[model samples]
Each structure stands twice: as C-alpha cells, then as structure tokens.
Target: MTGVNFQFTRGKRNKANRTRSPATERVLTQLKMISQRRKQPKLLQVCQEDHIRHETITTAFKLYRQEINANRAKLLLKQYESIKYAMEDLEQINSYLFHEANTNQKGKRFDLEMRIPTEYPPNQIWLHDYTPAEVAEKK
Candidate 1:
C-alpha cells in the first residue's frame, strides 16, 4: 500500500498514410486548382464554392496577407521617393526664380533671356550615405 500507483501506456500512433475525409480532400483539390489556374479567388467565393468555413480558408492562406502588405509597402515607398524628388525639384526652381527676380530688381533682365536650370545639383542626389565619416572628419 504505497501513496498512489498509476500505470501509463503509450497508444499506437496514427500512420502517416492515414486517409483524409472526402470533404477535406475535395477542399484541398479545389484550393490547388485555384492556385494552378492563377485565379485570385475572393474569400466569399472560396467559402461558397468549397463549402468550407471562412476560418479554414483564412488559415490556409495565412501568408498571403503578409505578402500583399509587403508589396503595398514597397509601392508606397517608391511613390514617396518620386514625390520627394519632385518637391526638391520644385524648391530648386522656386529659389532660382527668386534669384532671377532679385537680379531683375537690380536692373538686369536675365529671367526672360536665361533658361532656368532643371538638372539637380550633382552633390544632392545620393543612394547611400552621402556624407561619410571620413569626409566629415576632414571638414
């Protein structure tokens, strides 16, 4: 008569080759067909056609939201950069016009004779760190 004695036994595990239910098999087949056809099926359409729960459909394509968001973010970043470049160009033009107006006030009619410069300054455009530590140290 000890405290408490319990016997534990491990049950046989299910085999990997276990068959899926017909409904599950059909849903999987429909998903594969949709993917192969390159058709972007709407959630409601998939739910109606596959006769599966919306939760199941969402879980199966869980990574899709991340991919879509990533693409949207990339496109937004590109648009932002283009707009920034355009703004910089406009600012440069405004400064040029201001300078021309000042010169005209001083009796020089250069704005009508001289074409405004549209090209950006060479030192302004950059894809990486424009001012390196070495250059800053030299300055």
Candidate 2:
C-alpha cells in the first residue's frame, strides 16, 4: 500500500539429482553387474522400479540437452536473420557500400579481442578514473 515490495516466495521446483555427464553414466553402466552373492535375490517389483527410474533419468537428461541445443540454434538463427536484413537494407540504401560489405574475404578470421554481449549489464559502465600514458611518442 505504501511502497513497492520485492519479495521472493520459495516454491518447489522439479530438479534432477544427477551429478555426472551422460557419457560417464553410460560408461559406468557397462561396468555394473547384478548382485551375484544371493542369500536372497532382489524382488522383481524392485528391479522393475529401478529400471523405470533409470529410464526416467536418461529421458530427462536427453530432453534437457535437446532444449539447450534448440536454444543455441534459435540464437544463431536470430543473428543470421538480423545480418540478412541489415545487408538488404544497406543494398536498398546505397549499392556501393553494400557491395563493399558484400566483398568476399576468404582469409577473414574472427577478432580475438571481441567480447560477446551478456544478458545483464556489466558492474562497471565506463572507466571514469582512467588516464592515458604520458610518454611522448617518437616520430
């Protein structure tokens, strides 16, 4: 009623319990064997339940990996589209600049110094207390 409230309410979230990579899991699966020392063997129902749980975990990981891949593909597609549109707009605006941009460079490589943009703004906006080198340059 008075001011804005910023409160976070805890809620139950479905999270996986796996701590290992799927490849590692698969490799470990090959090394496992059913218990041989049988005073009493495990029940059929228990075995089935364990199998189901394994399948569920495998399915969940596969789904999660697929989701991640799809997101990456979507981001790449968006960037491609933006470039395509910008190029088209440039062509319409001026042919010379567009052709200059469209020139093929077979040996072009990505700049090592370029930084990828992040989802959130950085902690420091600009270097306000920065100073340039006072050393004089020889002609």
RMSD, one per candidate, in order: 21.6, 22.7
State the lDDT of candidate 1 residue by residue for 38-113, as single tens digits.
Answer: 6696765454547656667887688788888999999999999997787677668797755554463443234322
Over 1-139, each residue of candidate 2 has an lDDT whose tens digit, in order, gives 7775554545642235455568977777676644334478665665878999989999999999999999999999999999999999999999999998889977565543345788987677666754433322222
Local lDDT at 21 for model 2 = 67
lDDT of each: 0.66, 0.75
Clashes of 2: 0
What's the true lDDT of residue 128 in model 2? 75
What TM-score, computed on C-alpha atoms, does each candidate reach?
0.28, 0.43
Q: Where does model 1 exceed 4 Å of error?
A: 1-57, 96-139
As for candidate 2, its clashing pairs are none
